[model samples]
Structures are given as C-alpha cells and as structure tokens.
Target: MKIRSVLSAAVLAVAATFTSAQAFAQDTFTLKMAETWGPNFPIFGDTTKNFAKSVETMSNGRLKIRIDSANKHKAPLGVFDMVKAGQYDMGHSASYYWKGKVPETLFFTSMPFGMNAMEQYAWFYHGGGMELMQEVYGAHNMLSFPGGNTGVQMGGWFREEIKSLDDLKGLKMRIPGFAGEVFAEVGVNPTNIAPGELYTALERNTIDAVEWVGPALDLRLGFQQIADYYYTGWHEPATELQFLINKKVWEKLPADLKEILRVAMRTASYDMLVLSQHANAEAWANIKKDYPNVQIKQFPQDIFQAMYDANKKLLKEASASNEQAARIVKSQQDYLAQSRAYTDISERAYLNTMGTVE
Candidate 1:
C-alpha cells in the first residue's frame, strides 16, 4: 500500500508538470505594426490587413498583429524609425522612403528601368536580393521582407504633353525615391507631397505633375478628371513595398510563430501583386468609359533615351559612392539583363503574337 501511494504521487506530479509546459508553449503574443498608408487606402492598405489576418489564422490565435495606419501614427514616412526604435514591432512601407536616412535601403525598392515584378521576386527569394536587403536593414535593428509589389507604376499625370525632353525642364512634379532623383537629373524639379494633398496640389497648380501609383490607386485620387496625359511608366518598374520587423521582437518569437509570420508576409506580398493587376485593369476600364479626356501616352523616344541615360549615370554615381550599392546595382543589372532576355522571347513574344492575331 505504501509503494502504490508513492507511485500515484509521482504520476500526479508528472502530469501537472506536463500540463504546465503545454500551457507555456501555447502562450499568445500580440505585435503592433505601423504603416505608411492611410486607413482603408486601397490595395496598399489591404495588404497589411490581409497579412494580419493571415498571421492570426496561421498561428491559430497564438500571434496577433495590430496595425496602425498613418492617420493613427500621424507620421506617414516615419515607419522605419518607429519600428527600429521599437515603438512599433513591425512596419509596412516602401524601403525607398528611407533612402535619405539609409542610402543602401534605396536598392531594396524598385529602380528606374529595373526588372519587373516577376523577375524581381525571383531575384529576391531565389537570388541574393533577400540577403542583401537584410544586410542593409540588419544594422538598423530591423529585418526587412518584401511586403508587396505594384508591378509597373504609371509615370505620372501630366497637365501638359511631353513632346520632347525639353518639356521635362523646370517641371515641378510630386515624385519620390530614386526615380525622383533621376527626374531631377533630367532638369525636372521633383518634390515629395503627402498622398492626401496630391490631388489638391495638382488641381491648384501648386504642382505641375504627380507620379502616384498605377490606375487602381491613381483613380481614387481623381487624377483622370484633373490631368489629361497619363504617361506610361519607365521608373519604378516593380515598386515593392516592405515589411520591417524589429530584430528583438522577431527573435523573441517562437520558431513556429516566426515561420507563420514570414510565410504570411510572403503570401500577402504575392497576393498584392495579383490584386494590383486585377484592380488596375478594372480601374483602367472605368477610366476609359467615364473619363474620355484621359489619354494614355508614352514618352517620346528622345525623352526615354535621355532619361535612360540619366538613370545609368545616376546609378553609376550611386554605385561609386558605396561598395554595397555597387554590388546591389551590379546584381540587379546582371539579373535584369539575363531575365529580360528570356522574358522577351517568351512572355513578350506571346503577347506580341496575340496582338497580331487580334
């Protein structure tokens, strides 16, 4: 009887220990995220919300992401600082926005005449883009991942037709990032304006042109009614937004939770690209029907040639300044050259064939 009682006590203690351990493993965590976009701001905003939902679901409620849009944070462009300082655990914004603070960051976002969405994603995951991005962000105490891609952005809404390269001179435009620098090189005065004020600025003639995202997002700003010329894009061929996580916060997460967050972010990024395509197509169709005055135009050969040259010169200068920038630029140029060759022969060729048939 004494032996049986001792065995029973040992079994009870083991059961209690096991139960405690199981409860600890199921501990829940909630993270705060800051975004550059306004609340409910079309595709960009949706991406964050979708990511949050995905993380919650994949983690089975063990992890939750609370998002604060620009309105809540009151600092649209301060996402990087907020996340890095641990004011927010994560951030959603374009990496290029921090170029002034971190020059190497500019390479993570799209480049002028760079690879399109598909090729860039390939470079990111399969190639060394992710590793390079980490090297840039790791110093800031943050980890960066691709948040979303806007495929190829439209150039901008111009009030006047760009007949030649001369038209770009002295033109004040709301353009941002590396492309803005390229525009400046070509004699255009590039300025950064808040998205909320872009329409008013353009309408009031405070700005001569605005280079927002493509049709889906630009339509919301009513640019079609205000500006006639919707020029095609050469800059920001694949404007990829970023998901930035504070390194400490990320490290604190359990391995399972970490994977859930990573997968959620990646899935959300790809989803945004698909959503951009669908939404842009629908928005373009609507513009064609409702706004007949909005004419789609491409920059003339001379203007493109000059801007392309300017882009190369600017990239060369950027590379010369930093060794990392030089490596990133070379990697992109090399990948683009190789990828585009195959793309031209396959995707472009098929599209060209279809156009001829139709």
Candidate 2:
C-alpha cells in the first residue's frame, strides 16, 4: 500500500508539470513591427519603440514586439505590402507611401489647405473618419490606426525663393503623394524618393527641392544645409501617419491583447503629434540661431492661393471618378464642415480676439 501511494503521487506531479508548461506556452507572443524610418529619428523611431514597450508592459511580458527599422528586414516602402502579406505583423508608415497601390490613399495622408492636427484627430476619433479610413485599408487586407500627425508642414525647401508663379516652373522637387500632384499641376516636376536617398539627392542636384516632415526631422536630415530657402504656407496642412496591420493577424490577437494594442497605438499617436509640434517649434527657433543665412518666407499669397485652387480641383476630380475616394472624401468633408461650423463660433473668434490684444 505504501509503494502504491508513492507511485500515485509521482504520477500527479508529472501531470501538474505538463499542465503548467502548456499554460506558460500559451502566455507568450512575439510580433514584428516594421518602419521605413531609421531608428535614430526622434519621433517616429522613439514612438515605435514606445509602442513595443507599451504592448510588452501592458501584457506583463505576455507579448513582445520587435521593431524592424529602416531596411532591417525589408525596404521601407514595402511596409504595407509586407504587413498585408503577413511577412510583418504591423507597419508604421505614411498612408501616401502606398498611394500607387490605391490612388485614394493620399487623401488619408493629407489634404492641402485642410484640417490641422487637433481637428484631424477630432474628425478621426469622433467623426467616423477612422471607420471610413479602415474601409479603404480593409480592401488591402489590412487595418490602420492614426499613428502620428505632423501638424502643418513647410511648403518645402527650395534651392531658391519662390517669389512668383514663374519661379516654380521647371523646378524638380522630391515631393510625394497628392502634393506632388498639385506641384505637377503648377509645372513643378515632383519625384517620389525614399527618405534614405533624400539627402544625397538634394546634395547632388538630383532634385532641386524637397519637402520633408518639418523643422524637427528635416533639419536633422540636413535638408536645410543643402537647400537655401524654406517656404511655408501649409502645402500639407496636416499629414497623418498610420500604423497598418495584417487583418488576419489582427483578428487572431486575444481579445484583451487587441484592446491593449488599440489603446496603446492611439495613445502613442496622440503623444507623437503633440511632441512633434513642440519639437518643431523649438527647432524653428534653433534654425534661425544657427543658420542665419537661411531664408524663411511665407509663400506669397498669390502663389499659395493658386496651389490651393489646384489642390481643390484635383480633389473634386478624383472623388468624382473613384467610388472609394468619394466615400472617404465625403466623410472627411462632412466632418470638416461640422467642425469648422463649431470652431468658427468659438475657436476662430477666440483667435481673432487674441490677435487684437497686442
């Protein structure tokens, strides 16, 4: 009887160990997130790292994210395709980067003379814009979250000041997405070059001008060093960055883990926008101190107006031809109308009154 009892106890112990091992195996997850930006860039890289950290911490080590920055795994522009193909679980990118896949993707990135960062966020979160954007991504077998926003971008860095319409003619610029379309309309040839090639392109006269994120990232990339003139009038009033994930991978996440990812991505998105705005403000001041020779000019009113007109026309034309484009634009336009109506009464008035104070 004593020998039988001891054997039973050992059998129970082995069964318990097997159950424990199974539980531990179910608890850990490893995911890959990809980005085109170098790991050293301030907001993009740092934000990506924070996302991974947030997921790991929120999961209490149950999930781990490995960020593949720059060309660590694949070329940056292939982020969306890789995520869609399940090569990478997620991607951080500008929706416009994949504009070739879906011409309408540019609208999700920016609209010239369109909403600012805060208003765009409001439209996405509360105005149903997010759902509409997801609809576009859904066709690509992906889902996207608003990952970041560069409040208002500089028109671009030009080799020379653009003082008149004539000045823009024959200028070859490294601009992308819809703004590139607008530039083309205005007689500037726009080339879409990868971030890694921008500096060398600008240096070698491969491109006469280039527009990048803003003072923060652009200055760091040394664009200001190669280009003499910086023009601003919101070529891209607000540019939204996106995080895309394979739909299958997203669906497979445990419910709790999915919620955590959503919350973490949104938090990181908001934080990145606010941080970039502040950093750009500081960088502007620093640029003046260090590069006094740099010419900073508000784009001439006529030039700004012309470009705005071209962009508006392009938007109207694109929406009419593409059903998906029309849907996203209608959603965005409706939100903008409602938002502007409310803000005109409060925000616009406050700003006008404040301006008169001094």
Candidate 3:
C-alpha cells in the first residue's frame, strides 16, 4: 500500500509539471516592429536586428519579433506615429526626431553639450530620466526605452571650412532636435531630412551641410565622397536612440515577455555603443588614409559660445511654455551639474593626461 501511494504521488507531480510547460508553450506571441533605418544599414540597423534576435532567443521561441525597415514601411521618420497608432507594435528610432510634435522628447535624446554616453546612461537609469520619459510617452499612448547610443556625433559635413559665425548664417543644414533650434537661433536654417535623402540632398545642393551621425553611419551613406569638411560634434554628445512600443500592446504582453523585452532592449542599447566605437574607430582610420580631401575641423570658439547661449535661452523658453518641460529641463540640468563634476575630475582628467603621452 505504501509503495503504491508513493508511485501515484510522483506521477501526479510529473503531470502538473507537464501541464505548466504546455501552457507556457501554447502562449507564443509574435510582435511586429518598424525601424527608421533602411535595410541592414550598419550600426543603427544592426541594433534593431540584434534586439529582435535576442528577444526570440531569450524567450526560447515563446516570443518572436519581426522587424520592418524603412524601405518596407516607406516612412523613415514616422516611427513614433506608427507605433503610437498601433500600426506597428514597436519602433526603433531616435527620441529627439519627434521633438517638433513633443518638445519634451528632445531632452530624452542627447542634449547639446550635455552628458556623454556613460553619464547620460546613469542619468536615465539611476536619476529620474526614465520616469520623465515615460511621463512624456505615456501621454502619447506609447512606452519608450533607450534603443541605442552613437556616442558623440560629428557636428556635420560642410562643403567649405567654416571660419566664423558668419559662415553658419543662412546655411541650410540637416540638423534635428533642440540643437536645430539652437542653430536656428544663431541664424542657421536647420531642416530635418530623412536618412535616405541626406546624400542626395547634399549632392544636389538642396542643403548646404548634413549632420547625419558619426563615421560608422556617415561613411556607409558615402557622405565623405561629396563633402569636403567634417566638423567635430558639439550638438549631440550622447545621441541615444529610442525603442518605442504601443502602450496597449505592451499592456497585453505577459509579465515574463515584458521583462524579456526590457532586458533585450537594454542589452541591445549598450551593444550599439560598443559596436559604434569599434566601427567608428576603423572607419576613422580608413578616412585618414583614403579620404584625403576630407578635412576635420572644429567650430570657432565664438560659434560655440553663441550656440551655448542660444541653448540656455531655448531651455528657459521651453520650460516657461510647459510644466512638464519645466520638470524635465530642471531634472536634466540638475543631474548634469551633479554628474559632470565627477566626470571632469575622472574621465576628463584622464583624457587630458593621456593627451600628453608621446
């Protein structure tokens, strides 16, 4: 009697385990994503691909993500809208790109002369940045996560070397976000151009200059062939991209799947920064050897001062306009002030010391 009872209890335990496994297996889901980049467009596109693959792998086929690039979607800049409308379950793009519609979105991306990648990441995860971002996106019926980082972007590709502030005046450049507003304040006509149109726009003289991204992506787009001068970056120091999901779609996801997506997005975002460092370093070396006509330049000190002043002015104006913008701006400013002090003594000091070596 005792042996029979033991065997029956063991069989019941196995049956329960099998039933649980079956339930999980039957709850399979597939999500659709749209990206701003064209198909397989280097680091930016690679971020999305890596993210989708990681989600599927981690979930062990219980969850799958299907990515649609700009080529298929036919809207490179409409990612926020598509995801919000639930036309796509998710979107991979930059947050600042939507600043015209949501002014607070600009702060979530890199601010001009703001924190670097490391500092910005700290602010996002540790500081109040994530909550603030959710507050902004939640209103739009979407959830936003950090998609990727491009480190520091090049200021732009210029046809001719800019000697002074006068050179920037009346110059039509493809620059976006609050940086564009700052540029506009300093007399630059800042315009937002889709990534695919950048080469043609610059080649055809539709725009005088373009600030697409750093070398990894700019090189892929063949910007070096037509533009003679590449300037150092000041506008977008960290340039964190965004992964957006419809709030409704996210709410419908199982808790386990939501956590999986979160982990995948965070890992993918960090990986892009690493990949960018590797690819940009290699591309820079190649540029030096092959692109003889491409001269690297820096904006004059006066130009920097003017734009800095413009940035301050715009921040004040934006804060004055909206309560939420005020909170975000204040939060960012306070965080930057606290974080950058350490950065100056640590990373900046280390870099300065290294500059003297041989």
Candidate 4:
C-alpha cells in the first residue's frame, strides 16, 4: 500500500511539471514599441512594422509588438529615455542619437571612416560589438540591438559647392552623430534637425547644408530641387539603427520568446539594408534621368584630408577622457584593420577591376 502511494505521488508531480512547462510555452505577450520615425516613413518605418509582424507571426500569436511612431509619442528623440524609464517597453532609433546621454553609444552607429555594412555587421555579431554595446547600456537598465542598417550615407546636400576647407567654416549644417563632431572639428557648425523639417530648414537658410541618408530618402525631402550640389558620401558608412528594450521587460520574457524576438530583429535589420540598396539605386537613376540639374560632387583632396585629420584628432580626444570609450575605439580600430585588409583585396579589388574592364 505504501509503495502504491509513492508511485501515485510521483506520477502526480510529473504531471504538474508538464503542465507548468506547457503553461510557460503558451504565455502571451504584447509589447509596445516606440520609434523615432513618423508614421509610414519609408524604409525606416517599414523596419519596425516588419519586425512587429514577424514577431507575432513567428510566435504564433503568443507574442505581439505594437509600435508607436514619433508623431504619436511627440518625442522624436526621446526613445532612449522613454524605454529606459519603462514608459515604453522598446524603441527603434539610432545609437548615435544617444551620444548626449552616453558617449559610448555613438560608436555603435558608424564612424567617419568606419567599416562598410557587411564588415560592420560582422563586427556586431562575430566581433565584440554586441558585448561592448551591452556593457555600455547595461548600466542604464536597457538592452540595445541592431535594428536596421542604411549602408553608406551621402555626405550632404550643400547649397554651394565646398571648394575648400574655408567654405566649411561657420557653415550651419544639419548633421548628426559622431560625424557632426568631426564636422565641428573642421569648423562647421553641426546641428541636428528632425527629418520632417529638413527641407524648410535649408530653404529658409536655417541650415546651410544637410546630410541625410541617401538618394532614396534625400529625394523625398526635395533637397535635389533646392540644393544644387549633391555631395558624394564619406561621413557615415554603415549607419546602423538600434532597437532598445527595457531590462525588466526583457527579463520577463520566456526563453523561447526571447529567441524569437532576437531572430525577428536580426531578420528585419538585414531586410532594411537590402531595401535601402534597391531604393537608393532606383532613386539615383531617377535623379540622373529627371533631375539633371542636381550635380554630384566630391570634396577636393585637401578638404577630404582636413576632415580625415580632424576625425583622428576627435577620436583621440574622445579616448583620452573615457576608458570605456577608449576600449570601444580600440576594438573597432582593431577589427577594421583586420577586415579592411580582406575587403581591399577582395571587394575593392574586384570593383576596381570591373570598372576598368567595363
């Protein structure tokens, strides 16, 4: 009789364990996401929309993400703060935007002479980028992930051609991130402006130049019509947007759901980069065909040299003050040096060869 009682209790405990596991797997979650972009804002907006839909679909309705854009929240630049304070469960914005709050955050976006999209994404995943990013944001009670990538960005739309470094002095330009600091080092007055206001800012002389994404996005703002000189890209190569999640909120998610969110974020990010390439290519062709007046210009060698030197100087200054920043810089420089070697030999060499042949 005693043996029978022991066996019955054992079976009941196993049943209870199975039931708990089932309940855990079936748990439902609906997370709220706040974005920096306004509603229906092209590729950037599509990233968030795709991610939300993917999360729900992949999890079979166990997880859902509801997104609110800048217009809804009335805080275009408040994503980090809102998510950190738990006002929002997650956020979609660029890491560099949080430079004012955490200096190390800027490195996660893109540097002036940084790696290209392929190389940078490798660094983020295979390299130490993810660990470094977590260390920086961990103190702030948030977890940040690579949300999307805009590959290489154009220099800016300038009202006048930058004939020399002198032309850069006192120039009010709507530029952001670490590149802005580099521009400031070269005597340009760097300012940040929301996307919706860029066209008016330039037309009214509120800003002298604007460095937006690329042909795809810049064309939408009508910069080609007003700014006659469309400079080629040099500042932001592999500009990466980030997804922010509150630490408490992240911890509350089950293991399987956490993995689902990660896969969804990564997939959406890669898709955005592909979309950027297609859209930029299409838009560039259109600009050449329809907007012949828009002249594509590259900065003179001397101007490029000056900005390059200034970028180095600014990086040195940044490293001197903060150990964390110093470590992050070293990691990126080390990785860049290693990977750029292969890139030059392979990608760069092939492109050069193809250009000469065709």
Candidate 5:
C-alpha cells in the first residue's frame, strides 16, 4: 500500500512541472523605446510614437512598447550608448548626432550631396544599402532601421543671401554632423547649438544663420520672424532618421517580433515622408501670406555647382584614411549611380515638365 501511494504522488508532481513549463512559454513580453527628440514633434517624435502604437496593435497584447523621449530617463546625447549597452531596448535619433563616435555613421543618415529621401528609401530597403548599414552598426553592438527622412530641407535661414562661395567665409552657421565639416572646409564657422537655444542665438546675432528643417517646422518655430532670407537649395539634401536597437535585445527577440519591428519601421518611415511633404507645402503657402518680408530664393546654379564639386572632393579626402568610410563612399556612389538613372528618367523628368506646380 505504501509503495503504490508514493508512485502516485511522483506521477502528479511530474504533470504539474510540465504544466508550469507550458505556461511560462506562452507568456508575453515588452519592448522599451527611447529617443533624442522632444515628445510630439512632428516628423521626429510622432513617428516613434506611431511605431510604438503599431507594434502593440500588431502583436495583439503579446508585446507592448514604452517610449521615453529625450531627457526622460537619460540624456538625449547618450541615447546611442544607452541603447548599445542594453540600458534601453530601442532609440530614435538622427544619424548625424554620433559623428564623433562613428564617423561613417553619417553616410547612413545623409551625404553632402547624397540621394533624396525617396531615392535613399529605395537604396536602403531594396538597394543593398541596408546590408552595408548593418555591417557598420553591428560593430557598435546595434541594429538599425530607417525610421524617417526629412525629405530635401531648406538651404537654411540667413540674415543675408549667399551669392558667392566667398559669402560663406567667416560666417558662423549653426549646423551639425558631416555637413559641418564640409561647411568648415568652405570657410563657414559651424556651431552646434541645441534646439532650445537656436532661436535666441539667431535673434541676438550670436549665430549668423541657422538651418532647421523645412518651412513647416521652421515657420512653426518662428525662424521666419528672426531671419531675413530663407534659401531653397538644401545642402543637407535628405536627413534620414534612424531607429537603433540594442544588439542583444534585437538578437533575443523571437523571429516574429523581429519581423514586426522591421515592418513597423518601414511603415513609419513612409508615412513620415508623406506627412512632411504635405506639411511643408501648406506651410510654404501660409508663410508667404503671413510673412511678406521673408524672402525665399533658389540657389544660383554656379554656386550650387561649386558646392557640389567641393562636396565630392571633401568626401574623397575624408574617406582616404578610413576603410569603413571608404566602403560607405563606394556603396553610396554605386547606389547613386544605379538610382540616378531611374530618377533622372522618371521623377526628375516629370518635375521638370510640371515646373513646380502649386
């Protein structure tokens, strides 16, 4: 009788252990996101929040994302390091911010005369840019995806027009990233001013000029009131926003979760570009109506060509000593070669025929 009782007890214990294991396997998880921008800033913070929402809905409660904007839990500049160290799961920031850490990270974000937002999307998603991007970021214990792109930005607001390359000489301009290096080469003194202080710097004449986003964001920020001239030929071309995920966190995610993240990022990226396009159009019209003194001018062809040529030379010089930079330059040039053929034939031709309708 005693032996039979002991055998039955052992059988019940084995069944309970199996059930516990099954329950543990079925449990859900959460993802944390961080960003270096303020919350609710259109084209910047909005897309990140959109991503958080989309991931939650797609996962059907199995996964939830908590987004913390700049300075919420850590300093904005530390976002990359924090995410890399696994202090946070993910982050949203401009690729230019980390030029000091990884000089080549700039190519993934923007080039001096690089591809436009649309062409960049094509190159990154379908064109092999994504593969090389992985290689670069992998070195820093990160996984990245295209979060958003600010489509062609304004030439930047200035107290005076830049008629000749000489005009750039000795001018203190507020810009960031690799663009700063190029501007410096052209004789402009580049200064890094936080967003909060940008307006005061321009208003008080502390900085000669500042380049923010397009009219949509610029007008909203009240730069139109402070500066006399707003130029159209954006030197920064297209600013690609990045989503950085901690390498370990990325690797640990189940395959399904990883797929969800990639798809969500792509969706957010597309939506951001579209949003910026419409917003800029409306803002431009409204600005012309409201601010009559704000002179908007296209860059002269001669000046544009000179800057473009200088950009090429600067790129070659910068990459000469750095192999990774060389790889990025090669990839960018190759992708541009392949993409420009189509762009020139289709988009550029159509725009030329239409001649800036609206």
Candidate 6:
C-alpha cells in the first residue's frame, strides 16, 4: 500500500509539470496595428493585409496582427505619434509623413530624383539604409522597417503643360514631403491636402496640380477626368512606406516571433513593389484606351535642371543641420551613384535598345 501511494504521488507530479510545459509552449501573442490608409485602399491596404496573413501563417497562430485602418482609428496622419506612444504596437505609414515632428524621418522615404525601386531596396538591405533609418526612429522609441514601395511615382497631374521653370512659379500644387519642399524652392506653392479632397480641390481649381501615387492609386482618385497633362516622374523615384513598431513592444516579442515579423514585413514590402508594377501597367493601358483627353508629358530640360539643383541645395541644408542626417545623405548619395552606374549600363541600355526595336 505504501509503495502504490508513492508511485501515484510521483505520477501526479509529473503530469502537472507536463501540463505547465504544454501551456508555455502554446503561448500566443497578438499585436494591434494602425495604418495610415483608409479601409480597403487598394495596394497600400493590401500590403498590410498580406503582412498580417503572413505573420499568422508563419507563426502557426502563435503570433497575430490585428490591423485598424484610418477609418477605424480616425487618425491617418497620427500613426507615428500613436505607435511611439504605445497606443498601437505597430503602424503602417510613410516616414516622410512625420518629418515635421522628426526631421530625420524625411530621408527614409524617397528623395527628389533619388534611387529607383530596385536600387532603393538594395540600399535598404545592403547599403546601411536600414541601420540609418533605425537610428532616426530609435530616438522616438520606435523601430522603422520598409513597409512597401510605390515604385517611380508620376510627377503629377497638371491642368496645363509645364513649358519651363516659369510655369512652376506661383503654381499651387498638392504635393507632400521633401518633394514639396523642392517644389517650393522652385517657386511653386506646395500645399498639403487630404487624399479624399484631392479630386475636389483640383476640380474646383483650388490647386493647379496634384502629385499622388502612381497610376494604380492615382487612377482610383479620378485625377484623369480633371487634369489634362500627366507628367513623368522625377521627385520620388522610389517612395518607400514604413512599418513602425514600438520599441517596448518589439523587445517583448520572443526571438522567433520577432524574426517572423521581420520576414513578413520584408516580404510584404517587396510584394507591393511587384504588385505596383503590375497594377500600374494595367492602369496605364486602361487610361490610354479610355481617357483620350489625357496627355503624358515630361518636364522641360531647364525645369528638370532647376529642380535638380534645388533638390541638391535642400539636401545640403538638411545635412548641414544634423550630423546623423549628413551621414544618411552621404550614404544614399554614394550608394545611388554606384548603383545607377550599373543600372544605366544594364537596364537603361536594354530599354533604350528595345525602344528602337519596335
């Protein structure tokens, strides 16, 4: 009887230990995310959805991301502040959107006449861009990762043709970020208008031009109906959106879950670039076929030269003001020069050759 009681007690203790271990093994975590985009906002929205799905799948339900769009949060531009303050565990927005609050945040998004999508992605992964971006966001107790890319955005939708630098003078435009500053330097009056109000503003002649995303997103806003001229891109060759994670939230995540989040964000960012290319191609074809009144135009040589000079000057000023900004700018400039040289020989040469073939 004594031996049987001892064995029973030992077996009960082992079972309790096993149960505790199982519970720990099956522990789960859920992170709430706030996005700058409205509900079901095409490419931008799709990226976040993809990220959430990937995280859940990769973690086998151990980790989950619950996303709230601008409509739910009612604060499209408040992503950075909310994420930094721990109001949200994560956020999806452009880094430049917070430039007013943190000036160094401007450089994470594309600059005027900067690297293209491929070049910029390379820079982020291989050329110290991610480290520099983290340095900027770290001060705010957040971590920033590349959320997505818009590829090379169209310069803008203009009501009339831009003949020269003079055409930019006194031009009221809906442009944002560092690009807006560049335009302001070139004598344009740059204004910030909400995305929902862009069409009305243009239709009412409140703004002479609007610079939004590429064909994929711009078409949805019906800019073609109000604007006659669509200009080629120069300002934002690769506008990279950001994923913000609060440092405390990130630190609390288990190692495996952290890696899962990283991979999910990275993959989603690249996916958006490909998706943008595909969607833009289809949208451009539709616009050409349906919108006969729309004309595609490039800025004149003198205008491009002037804007280029203005961009360089602004960059210098930014770098001069902040030591970290100087390092980031120089890193990007150096990487771009090196990457572009090869791109000019390979992609550019091939495209130029193909242009004459047909």
lDDT (Cα atoms) of all candidates against the true structure: 0.93, 0.84, 0.91, 0.92, 0.84, 0.93
Query: What shift in Å separates residue 270 of candidate 6 from its native position after superposition?
Result: 0.0
At residue 23, candidate 4 shows an lDDT of 85
The digit string of per-residue lDDT tens for model 4 on 1-358 reads 9999999999999999999999877989888999998899999999999899889988999999999998899998899999999999999999988888888998998899888999999999999999999999999999999989998999989999899989999999998767888889889999988777999999999999999889999888899888889898888899899999999999999899999999999998899999999999999999999888889899999988988898989999999989999999999999999999999999999999999884
Best by TM-score: 6
User: What TM-score goes with each of the models?
Assistant: 0.94, 0.89, 0.90, 0.91, 0.91, 0.96
Candidate 1 lDDT tens digits, 253-296: 99999999999999999999999999999999999999999999
* Residue range 278-329, candidate 3, lDDT tens digits: 9999998898888999999999999999999999998899899799999998
Clashing pairs in 4: none
Q: Which stretches of candidate 6 lie over 4 Å from their true place?
A: 1-12
lDDT of candidate 5 over 1-358, digit per residue (tens): 8999998999889989998996665456687888888777777877888888898888776678888887687678888888888888888887778878888777888787788888888888788889888898899899888888778988799988878878888999998766677678778899989788999999999999998889889987788897889988546677788999988887777788789888999989888888888989999999999889899877677767766777888888879999988887887888888888889999999989899686
Error of 4 at 8 (Å): 22
The per-residue C-alpha lDDT of model 2 at residue 294 equals: 83
Please provide, for model 2 over 289-332, each residue's C-alpha lDDT reduced to its tens digit, 9 standing for 90 to 100: 98887888887888878888898898899888898888888888
**Candidate 3 accuracy as TM-score:** 0.90
Model 3 misses residue 303 by how many Å? Answer: 0.9
Write the residue-wise lDDT of candidate 6 on 1-358 in tens digits. 9999999999999999998998787778899999998899899999999999989999999999999999899999999999999999999999988888888888888988899989998999999998999889999999999999989999999998999888899999999778898899999999999887999999999999999888888999999998989999999999899999999999988889999999999999999999999999999999999999999999999889989999999999998879988999999999999999999999999999999985
Q: Tell me the alpha-carbon RMSD of every candidate.
A: 2.3, 2.8, 4.0, 4.0, 2.9, 1.7
